[model samples]
Target: SAVISQKPSRDICQRGTSLTIQCQVDSQVTMMFWYRQQPGQSLTLIATANQGSEATYESGFVIDKFPISRPNLTFSTLTVSNMSPEDSSIYLCSVEIGLHYGYTFGSGTRLTVV
Candidate 1:
């Protein structure tokens, strides 16, 4: 199993600004994913990060708005760009530990855009 550390547990930001969230895994992983959970809602898949290649984003999520970087097998980052009040949500990072072990998720970064 792999342990993940996500930065800036929570933040309050201006509507027009951007924020970058970082996810670091203790062990190397082949599949890492980013998700966003709105208030009182289910988790939504934002993107998938594979080492040495560009991230693949889900519908309604674009590279320009939610840029991702997977520099290696153990680290990745997600940036919420040109943020708006509607963008306020809980951002999380997850990794598939294995088929048997299931998945592990970060503590989550709560962003509130005013």
Candidate 2:
């Protein structure tokens, strides 16, 4: 099993500001993923980070808005660039537990832009 920790459980920021979130894992993992849950919405995949490679983002997400970095096997970071009120959402870090167990997510970083 892998344990993941995220910083800034909640924060409020001004428009046009950016916030960087850190994700640390207790165990080395092959893949780490980022997700967003807007108010009253379901979870959506932002990107998938793999060690030694660029992050693969999902549809409707671009690197300029949500840049990701995976420096090693146990750590990664996601930066929410150029924040806006529309960007307000719960950002979460996740990793697959096992072939049968599926993915496990961090508690989430709640961001509110105003």
Predicted structure with the largest lDDT when compared to the true one:
1
lDDT of 2: 0.93
Q: RMSD for each model, in Å, please?
A: 0.7, 0.8
Per-residue lDDT of candidate 1, residues 22-91 (tens digit): 9999999997999999999999999999999899999999999999999999999999999999999999
Q: Which residue pairs overlap in candidate 1's backbone?
A: none
Q: Which candidate has the highest TM-score of all?
A: 1
lDDT for model 1 comes to 0.95
On the 0 to 100 scale, the lDDT of residue 99 in model 2 is 93
Off by over 4 Å in 1: none
